[model samples]
Target: MTPSNQRCSVAIIGGGAAGITAAAVLRKRAPQLSVTIVEPSSTHDYQPAWTLVGAGEYDVATTRRRLKAVLPAGVSLIQQRAHSFEPTSNRVQLEDGSILEYEQLIVAAGLQTNWQLIDGLVDTLGKNGVCSNYSYDTAPYTWECVQGMQNGRALFTQPPMPIKCPGAPQKILYMAADHFKRKGRKVELGFCNAGPAIFGVPFYAKALMQVVKHYGIATHFGYNLVAVNGPGKEAVFETTVDGMKIRHIEKFDMLHVTPPQSAPDFIKNSPLADAAGFVAVNKHSLQSTLFPNVFALGDCAGTANSKTAAAVRAQAPIMVSNLLALRMGSALSAQYDGYASCPLTTSVGKIILAEFGYDGVVMPSFAADPRKPARRYWHLKKRFLPWLYWNQMLMGNTGPDWHAKREYPDTLPSISP
Candidate 1:
């Protein structure tokens, strides 16, 4: 069974931001340890750019690179999809029926887009005015729809809880409104969200409401999209509060759907997953609760953090440090506070960067007031974030905290919504 390749100290299951960063950190900390990353796709996508792409600001190719180009130089690459896991044998089962055993494991196979969950959505998406920002191919379709329409209900839906980038639903809505405003063709915009609040954090919620007011976006909280009649240009939304009385059917010229998302099915069904579905790991260490040798990060883990690339940068080193701590027989001292960032793009040039930690705590890294919308934060998001993401974070150079030394003003002022 063991015919070709040599065993590695760590086997990474996905080559996305979390998987790649984990590999980079592991190699940096333990140069002698063998590491390999198994990923199926050759194209590496910077998913944060999806927003800009939909806004007609960036193209799809601008956010992508060859997968091999970003991987650590010395690490072996297995360009294959993991079909299943055999944790009992410490082996990963690939689609080609090959076996790769390892000393430790890290699974970062990010969220899956369940486009088929809504009726007729699968056949109609990326065509016929039914588009989504979640897909790389369909992001431009959103812009095309925006450019093509001036009237009619432009419906944007946020699926149920636990989707990646929770604020993404609202972000797209604001951007779309801005596009219409700039074109001088005002369109009726409706936000149908599954949650009751615009945002999890109250400080940012206040700021978002102002943008909503300026753009005249109608909010229908507690509304979840259940069906899509794309050919007929209609979307069905069910009310969470009043299931029977509030069922509403509306026709739309454009629909921007943030599809329902979840941890990869294989990882969720395995022993590593907890009851609710997600790799069961200690929130602080990012290590498997049952098996100490296994670790998980990104959208796949049960860490009580918002899933974003910004969070992955904060999580990678902690997971790496803990894994190395195990190899060196040292007590694990590093901890992750569920730090995650969401750059809420309210306009083409402005962003309300919401940085928070465990339990939705607003942990701003910059000293500027959290309530005020400043150009500096937007500049950081536009100018510095990509550099920090590709050069510093993915390169395994982000130091711990990157936030610990920051001091935001508490006395400047506070805004309540």
Candidate 2:
């Protein structure tokens, strides 16, 4: 087959955390290897800070920066959307009818936020008290909705599992509840979770449940939001019990919706994906099982780890080390332990930093008991982490060494073998 387009030594499919980190590391470690980043966005967002932004504690502007500013020197940026992958020819097809050939491919294009999955959601989002922190555009509106409400029914909904930052859906709820309490507002707050549990890990779940009780939030397990009528201030939910599906309608004065998410359609439909539509890769190595030269990280990879930026931070180095080693015809020694961290902000001044790996093994980074809420953790979440993300992580100066050694069982079977 004939091809017409540009060529590079390495072509990264995304400019997000994973792609940027990989590029930064490659630039530093392998200077002669030409690199080009294909991304559609002009700005990069530090999404972890959006929870605080929604709570009116942090300014939204600080969470975003020009993508050019963060990218490493000597790395090329192609500000275009990738339409498809041609692995056999080692080429990527762009939306603008351009093709890029590469010696190796790294797919870090994060998940897609499917707001359209919920009926009437797209038209009403960021208006009529319907807000979502999942978006940079709508997050500020969440603060607006939170500020104007004196006290009524506030519903925070969590869609199914595998969403990025699983704790974020509830973290914002805690922020809103704390805000309402401080203002002496009488509000009926409800947390509608599509999943059956409060938290995935039991150690952290106990502490979170206490915070949930303190806020007097009614919990609805197995409830999934299916539709929203923003003008009417009504929401529709679906649930299953004993193999029977049920529908429930609830009225809300305010709604914070975490829309459903999945791997981007281009990656899902490509030959790189598994049955689940994620790029099929060896969970530990981050290398594509189908294609040796292809690697994936962040939300789009079918890894068993929680889809947090922390997971990507832990994953980037290993992916790069192994990738470079493969290029040198050396043995690949890097293996990811499925590390992920979730800073569960219990309140404004307190947080329970939940760090764990495969199979929910409690991995605490500090000497203090991770089960209890600590103000120090709050400081780390509010101030330190954002700085680290911008200065160290995206620049490829960080690794999983900061992750706390798992204090739990050694013999426990991990989610992956």
Candidate 3:
């Protein structure tokens, strides 16, 4: 078969946290190797701040930056969406019909937000008091809706499983409640969660329960939002019980909706994906099952971990190592034992830093007590994490041992292993 162009040492298929981080680590470790990033977006988002913005902590200007500024200089940056992958030739087909070849491929394209999954959710997001922190445009609307309403039913709905920052849906809820409490206008706060429990992790869930009671938030488990009548200010939810239920109408003064999410369409339809549409990779190494040259990181990888950017910080180094190893024609040894994290922002001053790996409770960073909510955790999330994410992680100036060393468990192996 004839090829279209010269094959690259590595073609990273994304410019977000995972992809860029991998590129930075690769260049730092092996400067001689050439890297090209194929990304569609010119602007990158610091999504962790979106929750803070929805809570009136930050404005839109603070959450975004030019992608060119963040990416490592001199690397070939192809600003295009990867439309399809040809693992046989180690090539990716861009949306513009251009093809890129890579000795190694890192699919850190991340998850897709499915606002269209819910009927009428997209049509009336910015208007009709429908707001979500998932988007930059809708985040301020959340604050706007929160501000305008004094004392009426304010419904916050968590769509379905596996959205980024699973705790984020409720985090905004608590902050909004805290806002009303401060103003002496504690409106009706209802948490319509799709999950069966308050939170997947129990340790933090216990702390969450205390806060829920403190703020007097009505927690409804197993209730999923099915439809939104935004013009009428009404939301329809379906109950997970045996009822095969229809919509239960609930009028709202303000509605904050976290939409359901899934893997990107291309990955889901490709052989690279699992049943859930996530890229099927070794849970430890993040290399694809079908192709050794192919790897995935971040939310798109099918690992048994909470999909969080904090986890991406840890996985980026592992992916880089394994990708480099594959390029050197060696067996991978680095493993990423599903180390995902979520910063459960209980309030403006408090946070439960939920850092755990697979098989429940793997927090080597939190040597002290990972269970209890600490002011230190709050400080780290509110003050330090953003700095660490931007100045360190994105800029490739992170902790010295971030991707170079393993600190979690002695018995476990690296994800690339």
Task: Give the per-residue lDDT digits (tens) of candidate 3, residues 128-204.
Answer: 88899998888988888888878989988887778887889988988888788878895999999988878886655
lDDT (tens digit, per residue) of candidate 1 on 291-386: 888999999888879989989989998899998898889987899988888988877777777888887677877766666655566677766777
> Candidate 1 has what TM-score?
0.94
Clashes of each: 0, 0, 10
Could you arrange the candidates by TM-score from highest to lowest?
Answer: 2, 1, 3
Best by TM-score: 2
Question: For all the candidates, what are their Cα RMSDs to the real structure?
Answer: 2.6, 4.1, 5.5
Q: After superposition, how far is residue 1 of candidate 1 from its true place, in Å?
A: 11
Off by over 4 Å in 3: 1-6, 362-364, 400-417
Candidate 2 lDDT score relative to the true structure: 0.90
lDDT (CA) for every model shown? 0.83, 0.90, 0.81
Candidate 1 residue runs with Cα over 4 Å from true position: 1-6, 242-246, 399-401, 404-417
TM-score of 2: 0.95
Give residue 327's lDDT in candidate 1 (0 to 100): 80
> For model 2, how does the per-residue alpha-carbon lDDT over 1-417 read when each residue is reduced to its tens digit?
453588998899999988998899888889999999999999999999999999888899999999999999999999999999999989899988889999999999999999999999999999999999998899999999999889899999999977999999999898888889889999899999999889888767777877888889999999999999999999999999899999999999999999999989999899999998999999999999999999999989999899999999889889999999999999888998899999988777788788999888777787666767778888899899999999999988875366656564323221100
Please list all clashing residue pairs in model 1, or write none if there are none: none
Checking candidate 3 for backbone clashes, the offending pairs are 284-415, 285-415, 285-416, 334-414, 334-415, 334-416, 335-414, 335-415, 336-414, 336-415
